[model samples]
Target: MRVKDFIWLSGLLTVISLPLSAAENDWPVYGGDNLHQRHSKLTQINKSNVTGLIEAWEFDTGVNDTFQATPVVQDGVMYVSLPFNDVIALDAATGKQLWRYQHDLDKDYPICCGSANRGVAVSNGMVFTGTIDARLIALDAKTGKKRWDHRVIGENTGISEDASKLEDTELGSVSGTSGAGINMAPMIYQDTVIIGITGVGYGLHLDAVDSDSPLGTVVGIAGKYGRRGFMAGYDIHTGEQKWQFDTIKSENWEGNFVTKTADGVELPRNITNEKAALQENADAWRYGGASAWSTPVIDPYTGILHFGTGNPSPQMEGSSRPGDNLYSSSLLALDASSGDYRWHYQQVPHDLWGYDVASPPVLFDITIRGQPVPAIGQAGKTGWFYVHDRRNGNFLYKSEAFVPQKNMFSLPSAEGTIIYPGVMGGANWSPVSVDARRRLVFIPGIHWPVEYKLHQQAASEGKDAVRYSSMSPINTPEKHGLLTAIDLDSGKIVWQVKTENPLIGGVLSTASGLVFTGEGSGELMAFDADSGEKRWSGKTDAGVNAPPITYRIDGKQYIAVAVGGNRLFGFKTGQKIKVWRLP
Candidate 1:
């Protein structure tokens, strides 16, 4: 292959918006670009002046719960989303709230995950977000007023009004269940606006927000007209649907429940949109796991859509759906144009720990062996880090090991040992930073256990009885969290900075010869990309799940982070975005 073509095919240079230092390099979308690199090109805030950073300003985001919002900045204006699904436009330099678009979320949200709004995607002079309340909203980039609202999920997505209004009746309960809602920021690929639904049969059933009947199809709505998740494309100016993809089957679903164990293969309690329909073979989609819950990474150049899946339903039980659930807890590669599964890698076969591969996959090319190849490195919620070939989902580097015989799966020869990073992900929802300079992937990871206790009406009615329906907070069993630098080529840990709390928030590395990391304990820190020594850090009001960003306004280098305990990540306070400028 030609060197240039080989590098492109190797997954290097995903054609993301080349950050141009100023407004040109704005961290505008979730993952920074379609590839979700969470990387930046600014070097002004490098290791040299990093320690001199002093608080410039702070904005009151007014949120409660662990907020993990990646702010989108455009034209000197910053757009941030929060746990309550509130979108606010702020002055980029001053941190002043310009306009706030509240999602109208109630104190009680019916979903397993706590209140978290990943963030927003902007284009054509409008800010877009998939709301916790199940609506896809577009706002004026300048004023933050709602331009149009398309009920992408919930009742607006064709849900019954009564059903849509159901409260998160199961929070703090043992069942630990939540209903349908949009949490991941809506993905914008070129002109088509894509969104996915998480939470699950939650309090409702699977397919609760499976909106639009045929359920589980990647709907592409138009940017112009207001089309909702219906029809197809919306006019760039009209917001109308131009086209649509529906999950309709020619026949009813059919599949016998795994009444008897075979080779002790766990019976699949759930199925994919395809299997769900096949198992029913009747006319309805099954009620188990099988939902599109993660934001997809797009190969803007190749137009391939890569997304991860959630656990097959029944929450914690895997015996329900056995035999390597086709796509659940899997990484799927599809033709962005046709939505066809080109290839897939099941991170967890029939996941029982509820280890959903819902985290965003970071894409970049690694100089493997002697050839630079296109590959992906992913950190899942369960804490597993996987480096695979993006072109075909092949393992490029294997650092984290499999569970071996820990998970009771009888193998002819141990197959591919399930060495997942764990549900909290060796790298979780908190993103990682990719340094092109050193070709290293900087990931903050959680090393904790999520001991699941089978919920059986829990004898009577107490906390234990309703725990499954709750979001488990962080408890790091004393093992210091790690900020691991992995040699992408070898999947080898170059250097690991062990901190007190789990290395929780996202990461950003700069060309200025420095790397930035955050913690769930309100600690924003800096480290030498080449060394593991901590050069600086500071305590704020809450944990830092929100990644840090750097930019230059008037030749002065600046750093910033959103301080709010991720109610979901174990933090309970903090409501401001703190900025620091080099003195």
Candidate 2:
């Protein structure tokens, strides 16, 4: 059956747009609206005229690092955060610099990923950002001057004594070990700015040897090397923290120890061993790792905030942190006002495969079993698009696998077990876009097979023996990208398109029926939102590995994206923000 047959959209679009506050012509929030739909209502640049788009202007940030920020525009001014947490305001129409605030970094700090700030939040004449050194700062939107700054990671905040001691030992000398920091953009609700920390899921991440290739290997060292992850709310004007929610709960961190996923897919887990180790590791939550990797989408009417979490500590090795690892590798909902827990759905129970709910959640309304249901959808690294009822966290259905899947939950072996949709994900940190009118969700996905291998190093010459596991992309099956559109009502794939390289950026959909996304190959392409037809393509000097946003200034609509190549994925680095409009 056709997608439109299953999805009745005549009256549903009006209900979905009631609670969103973003203007029809302005890109106000990071995901285009509070729903995080990434869908614009403007149709000035529709599919028929998309091919006539020409470069309106281009601005250089002067810093060449991994640029992954989605530019936020309001009142003809654009606020964007660059690499190293530098925030800049630009004239939206002409791409002229208005004011720039340079963030000074500490000489030494901990960073799990490369230097990249996703974007900034603007509210009540102020711009807010979370720094790489774990600091949250607010700036004057007009003058670009600092208003207030708050240290997010306080002394012994997320740290444990045993984990700190491990950092001082010889084990800390291992390459690719990371520390705490924040890379996601801040989300502003009514009077509070919400942000989260990342890299707490400690693992050894070695980059590819070749500059033009994918990542080399991710080694999971078996020890307590990471701290707990959290999301907090701060006062907009004073930068005073209002409330904080730690991802891992201390007392009941050991969950039900389910041997399968919430969807009844049997996971390759040693449940008996996990239950046996539960009491011994009762205090494991102190160093538990469940990093918050993406900005959350809030339901204004219900006052509920929904977000996703990363992998557990000791990443690929699950022996150290046993049980279901409550809240990690799951989709969580909390009260927006109080930060109180609402409900959670663990996608991967006892996760040892590095399958994080890394992508941001998109909220919409869907028809399930002929009844209208308010729903939330998230693209998972496990290669499926999961849909659930937003009110109570009930599993509605999962879309067909967008990428190939083989031995999905297999354990790593000394001889190496190959798994598709591996660590890099069926979908990574890229945010998905939703078309509420059509009941379709667009996702940017990666298809790379990884070889999971276990290793043991013998004790020698004052060094203790260690066991570690590595996940490296294998050469077989060739890596590529998959841009898919799934029908929300039927949980079926409507259209799929393949690209030459793996996709790491986010997607944008417009009311004019055009879907826009960038590629690591330095091309910005537009597709027909319903049929997946190629509409247009443009080239840039660097890889367009960032989410695209659209806005209207005076009378014309413009599409903008950052053109900084991702360093870890071997894309060519750049420092340009390219804007285009119909000529």
List the global CA lDDT of all models: 0.59, 0.85
Cα deviation of 100, candidate 2, in Å: 0.1
Candidate with maximal TM-score: 2
* lDDT (tens digit, per residue) of candidate 2 on 100-165: 999989756755567888988899999999988889999999999999999988753433323222
The root-mean-square deviation over C-alpha atoms between each candidate and the true structure, in angstroms, is: 8.6, 4.2
Model 2: CA > 4 A from native: 1-13, 18-22, 156-173, 206-214, 475-477
Compare the candidates by lDDT and give the number of the best one. 2
Model 1 reaches what TM-score against the true structure? Answer: 0.77
lDDT of 1 by residue, 139-240 (tens): 888788888887554332221212222123322111223355677766666677776666542222223332221111111110111111111223334454
